[model samples]
Target: MINVFQPSLGEAEAAAVAEVFASNWTGRGPRTAAFEAEFAAHLGVPAEQLLFTNSCTSGLFLAVELLELGPGDEVVLPSVSFVAAANAVAAAGARPVFCDSDERTLNPTVAHVEAALTDRTRAVLVLHYGGRPGDIAGIAALCRERGLTLVEDAACAVASAVGETACGTFGDLASWSFDSMKTLVTGDGGALYVRDPELARRARQLAYYGLETASSLDAAGHSDRWWEPRVGGFGRRIVGNDVTAAIGSVQLRRLPDFVARRRELTELYDRLLAGVAGVRTPPTLPAGHRDSYYFYWVQLDPAIRDGVAADLLAADIYTTFRYPALHRVPIYGAGELTLPGAEAAADRTLLLPLHQGLTDAQAHTVVEALAGAVAGRAGAAPAGE
Candidate 1:
């Protein structure tokens, strides 16, 4: 079966992990630090501004926590994003004000964010959906005007850019994912980029239980004061370790090739499904903007979406919806919120298999399957037949 999501890893990753195993020092040590530095360099950011975390969720939570928001504070974010963004705000004892998505981009625009703002709004969380860059400059301008903090949820946007400026660089703080299914697979790890040095330092300490720094042992590998460790304020153990960083370091080196292949496959899908009726491809990105193509989302008629997904599965081509509206989720207790664009996206959007491992022929097969499914539904009888 053609999977909707798949990770491509090979001997390079295995060799990296083997080196860590041989060293027998696989905790959060030298390898993790090296990975963080390399990743920061890749994004053209200073090493001092990056913080490595176990997952994008943790990075986002750290960003929210840095704001020191509480029950009275509200964070405006797209309701079509992964539930983690809202979960992070909720975890920080803040309210998440859901915003609608733009029909074309499937991402919340500056207008949508502006509409969601209330007197209690303290921050704006923008997600680059499917690795497609949103209108960050406009949103940043609005944030500046309102004196609001901008937190970028760039989990699917590693290496994505707008005119050479990376997506994570536009906000006060941003979180990037290198999970098993993302463009850069790190088993399960992420990084947080903070524009402020103090925030970056605090994030590092908070990730590791607020442990106080101390000097390294002597050259002889012996510590005269082994029991003199210092403790600081309360914190959580949400930092990445050397084991995962080992894998991530190798994956980072292959990110350019991975992104290229995914784009090639996506272009093939675009050409193959250009004329199919009842199916709409993702928005065409403007010039100077680049999408990482983490997922190739297509919008179908909401009434026939389920039928097409079932037909694709039966044909051995897996497909699934991208995201459900966050406000409708039971855990958030935001059912009363009305976000038409997000609700429309939740019902019509489906993710096609677009990864480095997918070949041109495989992409054609996926498009064929989708086209056939939609065509079959178009000619089907009415309900109760």
Candidate 2:
């Protein structure tokens, strides 16, 4: 069976993990600090601006929490994104205002976001879906003019540049993921990056049970030899352990290679499926935005989409349904959203296997199966009566 997603981890990762195990300090110590420093440097930001967390979901939630948004406030986001985007806003005690995406790109347009904004809107969460930049500059401009904070959920996109600038560097704050299936994986890890010093300080404090590490201790009037947290924030530390950080550091070093390999596979798919029947490949971004292929999605013409997924499944190729429009989900436990474009993509978007492990042969096999599925379905339709 050909799997849709497989992480590329081998002796190098094992060696790093072994080293961490050998060391006695395995909790948010030297290794974690090192990983943070390296990750920040990769983003071209100062080291102090980044904070690591257990998952991208946690980073998103923490970012919203620090913003002090609550019940009366709202955060605007596209319904086409992973549910984590919606959940994070809800976790912050704020509402998520769902918007539509341009059908071709699968990302929320600036106009769509502006339409969703209301007096209560406090922030906008933009996702770099499938490793493509989602109009970062335009969205940033809109957010600035509207007095709204921009929080980038760049979990699927890392090291992707937009007009010579990286995606993660555009927003006021951003959350990144290192899930096993992502372009850069650490089994499970995440980070938060902030451009403001005060916010960075507060985020650092929040991550570690609101304790002031040595830095905060030095500021206090310590007459005693031993130092402690100046003010009680919660002694429970949210800091990640060293074992995962060590693994993450190694993954960080190999990220460029991973991106390159995935791009190679995507270009191959583009060549094969360029004008295939009943298929629409994910659209290309403007010239300034580059892609990092975390997922390679295609749209099936409705006439044959239903059979497309089952056919791929029968052929032992794994496929996924990215997301239904958030407003349409029963998470509201209610009826439906009024978004037409998002609803259309939600029903038709199909993900093709595109991971670092995918070979030239595997890419061809999936494309062949897809072509057959679409043709078979189109051929089987009932004749006009």
Candidate 3:
């Protein structure tokens, strides 16, 4: 079956893991530190500012906590966002203000964020939707003018950038996912970036039981009391281990090739699906916008959306929607909020299978199958009809 998401792994990854296993130490050791330095270089940041976490979700939670968000503080984010972003705000006793996204791009614009702003709002968390660096520069400027903190959920945007500036670096703090299905897979691990130097120091300490020092390696050569940790505050062990980093380093090295292939596939899909009836492709990126091509979504007539998905599945192709509108979620206490743009996009958008594992032949096959499915929809009207 053609999967909606897949990671490209091989003998190199296996060798990395084997090396980790051969070493006696595996928990947040030398390999983890080296990977952090490598990733920091990838994002063009100081190595000291980067910290590895167990997942991007943990990074979100850590970002929220670092900002000290609590009751009465609001975090404005797109309603069409990953559950982790909303949960991080909600779990911290802060309100997650859901905003509308552009119907075609499925990304909230600066105007969408402005409309959601209140005196109670403290921060703005924006996702680079489908790994497109959507309005992040504008939003960062907005946040600065308003004196609001910005946290970028760059989970889908590890390689995305505007020119040479990375997406995650646009905000005060950001999180990246390196999970099994992400562009750069590490089995299960993530990286966090804090812009402020002092805050970055605290971020690393806080990620690992709030210890004053980094790890045993620092004390190993300095003193006899190597095991005694100087507790800075109550924290948790959320640091990424060398076992995962070993694999991540290899994946990171191959990222450029992976992104190039995805870009090729994206253009191919665009050419093939351009004239397919009842289908609407995602909008093209503006100038200087480099998308990671994390998600290749197509919007269809809402009435026939489900039927088309069923047809695709029957043909042994797998597809799914991401990020149902968070405003409509009753748990967030904003179920009555009217976000026409987000609601519209949610009903019609469908993610097509686009990953490093997908070959050119498979991409053509996907479009062919999609075209056939849409054609088979007897009563399906063209998208706007």
Candidate 4:
């Protein structure tokens, strides 16, 4: 079966892994440090500005913690995002305030987030959906106007851009995922980018369990040596590891090519299925915004989604619904939250076969199958058909 998500790891990745295996140091050390340096450089930031973590989730959790967000604090984010976005806030002892998104962009707009802000609102978490960058400048302006911190959840947005600025660099602190399914696969890894030196230092502290790294809490003002572990700070780093970074560096080198391939695939899908009935492809972003096209999401008319999905499955063409609405998930509990657009997207959005390795033929096959399935459903007569 053509899988919905596949990590396009080949000789390059295997070679990287083999190198790590050959080396005795598999913990978070040289390789991890190098990866962080390379990633920060890629983002046009100083090496000292980045922190590597186990997962984007951990990076986000660390961001929330560094900001001292707590039970009385409210963090605003789009309800349509990955549940991890909300969970990070909840994990930080902050309330997750859900907001509506722009239907056209499928992104949380600055106006919507601004409207959701309460007196308790502490930070704004913005996610770049489907690898398309959100309106970072507008959101940043809103955050500045309101004196709120901005945390970017850029798990799907590696290499994505809005105008000239990269998606992950717009917010005060941004988290990126290098999980197997993302554009950049690192086994299971993530990174954090910070614009502020002090916050960056604090984030490193939190990621390493509040350990007084030489760069962080060195009261002696020595730059080379770390102070002895203090009793109060969170002790021991849990997430950052070397093996993941070893794999990550290789993936990072290929990121530009992977992003280009996905965009090419998306263009091919748009062309192949342009006028197909009941198949609504999301619009391309304005030229200034470079969308990485991680998942080519389609909005199927409610009537045919299930049948079409089943047909694709039978044809050995895999597909997926990226996520269900946060409130709809049993774990989050069904609150009194009313988000119509998010609820509709949860019901109708379908992720077609999209990855760096998908060929033109495979993309066309899925589109053709989707059209056929929708047509077959339309022709069905009542329940007896």
Candidate 5:
């Protein structure tokens, strides 16, 4: 069976973990700190700006929590995004206002965000869906003009960039993922990058039990009080441990190669599927931007999408829909808000296998299966009465 997603871990990762096991210091220790530094360096950002977490969800939650939002405050986000973006806003006691995506790109534009803005709106969460960078520069300008915070959900965008600048650096705060299926697999972990020093300090304390670490203690005072622990704020055990960090450091070294392989596979898929009837490939990215290709998505006629997915499953080739429209979800409430683009995308988009481990033959097989499925569905269509 061909998997839609898989992590590329090998002897290097195993050796890293083995070393961690041998060290006997596997909690939030030197290895974790080293990973944070290396990750920031990869993005060309300062080490002080990054805070490692247990998952991207936790990083996002910390971003919202730092804003100190409450029931009266609101955060606007696209309905087509992963539910975690909405969940983070809700977790911070802020209402998540749903917005529409641009049908071509499957990401929200500045106009869609503007339309959702209310006086109570405090922030805008922008997700780089499928590792494709959205209009982040434009969105950042709008956020600045409106006095709103910008939090980037860069979970799928490890090395993705708009022009020469990276995606995560544009927003005021950003969250990155390194879960089992993400571009950088740390087994299960994430990181938060914040522009504000106070926010970074708060996030670091929050990751632990609100207690100052030994380094922080030295900075505060070196007197007799140095031996005593200080609890400065409310917190939780959300920090990523050294064991996972060790693995992540090794993965980090190989990210450029991983991204390159995925891009090559995506190009093959595009070449194979071009001009196939009733099939719409993902929009070509604008010049100066690059996608990490976390999932190579294509849109099929909504009527036959389900059948095509089933056909692929029967062929032992796995596929999936990226996400459902968040506003239509029950827990987010059955709001009257209408997002035509989001609804349209939810009904038609399908994710094909595009991971580091996928070979040229596997990609060809996937495209062939899809073409056959589309043809079968076309032939079975009812004639006009």
Candidate 6:
């Protein structure tokens, strides 16, 4: 069966892990630090600005804590975002204000974010939906004007950028994912970046038990009493391990080829599904917008979306929608708000299989199945009607 997300791994990753195993020191160590530095370079940021974490979820939670958000604060984020982003804010005693997104793009516009802002709003967190850097520049400008914090959930945008500047660097703080399914597969890991050097230093400490201690390898490097650790702040041990980092380093080297193949597949899908009945392909990106091509999605008639998806499933072509609208999620307490844009996305959007492993034949098979599904159901009434 075709998968919507799959990691491209092989001998290189296995060999890297083998090396890590042979080294005898596999916790957060030289390999982890090297991976962070390389990733920072990829994002065009200082090495000190990045902190490796266990997962993107951990980075999100760390972002909330580092921002010092609390009960009276409200973090404005796109409704079509990962649950962890909302959970992070809500868990931190801060209110999460869910905003709308463009129906076609599934990313919040600056207007949508501004509409959700209240006097209580302290920060704005937005995901680069499907790896499109949606209005982030304008939102950054808006955040600057309002003196509010901006945190970018760049989990989908490992290689996305407006121009030379990276997507994750636009905001005050940002986080990225490197899980098995993500563009950069590390099995399970993430990283955080803080614009301020001071805050970045503090955040690094906070991730590792908030301790100002001499590391195990270089115990005597810092001071005489290397055994004694100073507990600095309230924090958690959520650092990425050297094993995953080893795999990440190898993956990072091979990322360009992965991205190129995905782009090739994306273009093929666009052409293949161009005229399929009831199908609406993703809109062309604006000038200077470089997509990471993490997810390739299409919109269909909401009434028949589920039916078409079921048909595709039966045909062995996996299809699904990401990010059910967060506002409708009862836990956020914004279920009553009418957000047609986000609602439209939740109802009509379907993500097709667009992973690095997908071949030209696989893509053709998916499009063929999709076309057949839509055509078969086109003449019929909506599923239940």
Candidate topping TM-score:
6
List lDDT for all candidates, in order: 0.87, 0.83, 0.93, 0.82, 0.89, 0.91
Candidate 4 per-residue lDDT over residues 1-385, each given as its tens digit = 8877788888988888788888987877788899999998888888888988888988887788778888889988888888888898887677888887766467877777987899999999988888888677899989998999999999988888877788888879999998888889888889998899987877776677676553345456664444555533663464577788988898999989988898899889889888887678897687788887888888876666777789889999888887666766665544788877777787788899889888888887888888888788767736643
Candidate 2 lDDT over residue span 1-385, tens digit each? 7777788888888998899888877777788889999999888888898987888887888788788889888898988888898988887678888888888778888999999999999999988888789788899999999988999998988777688777878889998888888877888888889878889888888877776663444555654643544643543345566888888888888988888899899889989999898788877667878787888888986656767888899999989877667887766422555888887888778889988888899999999999888888878877640
Best by lDDT: 3
Ranked by TM-score from best down, the candidates are 6, 3, 5, 1, 2, 4
- Give stretches of model 5 more than 4 Å off: 214-229, 383-385
Residue-wise C-alpha lDDT for candidate 3, range 1-385, written one tens digit per residue: 9999999999999999999999977888889999999999999999999998899999999999899999999999999999999999999999999999999998889999999999999999999998999999999999999999999999999899998999999989999999999999998989999999999988898899999887676889788889888899777889999999999999999999999999999999999999898899989899999999999999988888888899999999998999799998899999579999999999999999999889889998899999988887845565555
TM-score of 2: 0.94
lDDT of 3 at 205: 85
State, as a TM-score between 0 and 1, how close model 4 is to the true structure. Answer: 0.92
Judged by whole-model lDDT over C-alpha atoms, candidate 4 comes out at 0.82
Candidate that beats the other on lDDT, 3 or 4, i.e. the better one: 3
Candidate 1 weakest lDDT stretch, 10 residues: 214-223
Off by over 4 Å in 6: 214-225, 382-385
Score every model by TM-score: 0.95, 0.94, 0.96, 0.92, 0.96, 0.97
Angstrom error of the Cα, residue 236, model 2: value is 5.9
Q: In order, how many clashes per candidate? A: 0, 1, 0, 1, 0, 0
lDDT of 2: 0.83
Evaluation by TM-score, superior candidate among 2 and 6: 6
Please, what are the lDDT tens digits per residue for candidate 6 over residues 228-295?
77789988998999999999999999999989999999999888887776789999999999999998
lDDT of 2 at 299: 91
**Ten-residue segment with the worst summed lDDT in candidate 4?**
223-232
Screening candidate 5 with a backbone cut-off below 3 angstroms (N, C-alpha, C), the clashing residue pairs are: none
